[model samples]
Target: MRKTRAVLVSAAVVLGATLTIGATPAHAETLAGVFREHSECERVGTRGTDQGWWDDYSCEWEGRYRYYFLYA
Candidate 1:
């Protein structure tokens, strides 16, 4: 009876650990420190920064919030 109880307790502990590890969520990827293409429409600038492909031209605009990535 003691041996059976020990085996049951060990199984419960292993199962609990496995479930806890598997229940965690995975991390997500972010877009930072990458080249992008910029374009200005009206007074708002739109940019596409995915991977390292920059093919864009900018025109003069007023009261626009523009963002760009810098490499050092």
Candidate 2:
């Protein structure tokens, strides 16, 4: 019975560590959307945080459009 319990605990620890490693983001930021207006981009990025999809966001201009990025 002790051996069986030890094996079960070891398996649980391994599974948890795997999940933690897999859940982390490999990159700092990823593009969420692009908009023609700055306000619109900010609005959408704000909504994303409010909805709990992203922790934080930033915007940048490329050409005539604004790009939105969400970072973990």
Tell me the lDDT of candidate 2.
Answer: 0.77
The parts of candidate 1 lying over 4 Å away from their true place are 26-72
Best by lDDT: 2
lDDT of 2 by residue, 1-72 (tens): 999999999999999999998895655687888777788888888899999999888877776443433333
Alpha-carbon error at 63 in model 2, in Å?
A: 2.8
Per-residue lDDT of candidate 1, residues 2-66 (tens digit): 99999999999999999998885543233324233332231222343232333342333233434
lDDT of 1 at 59: 39
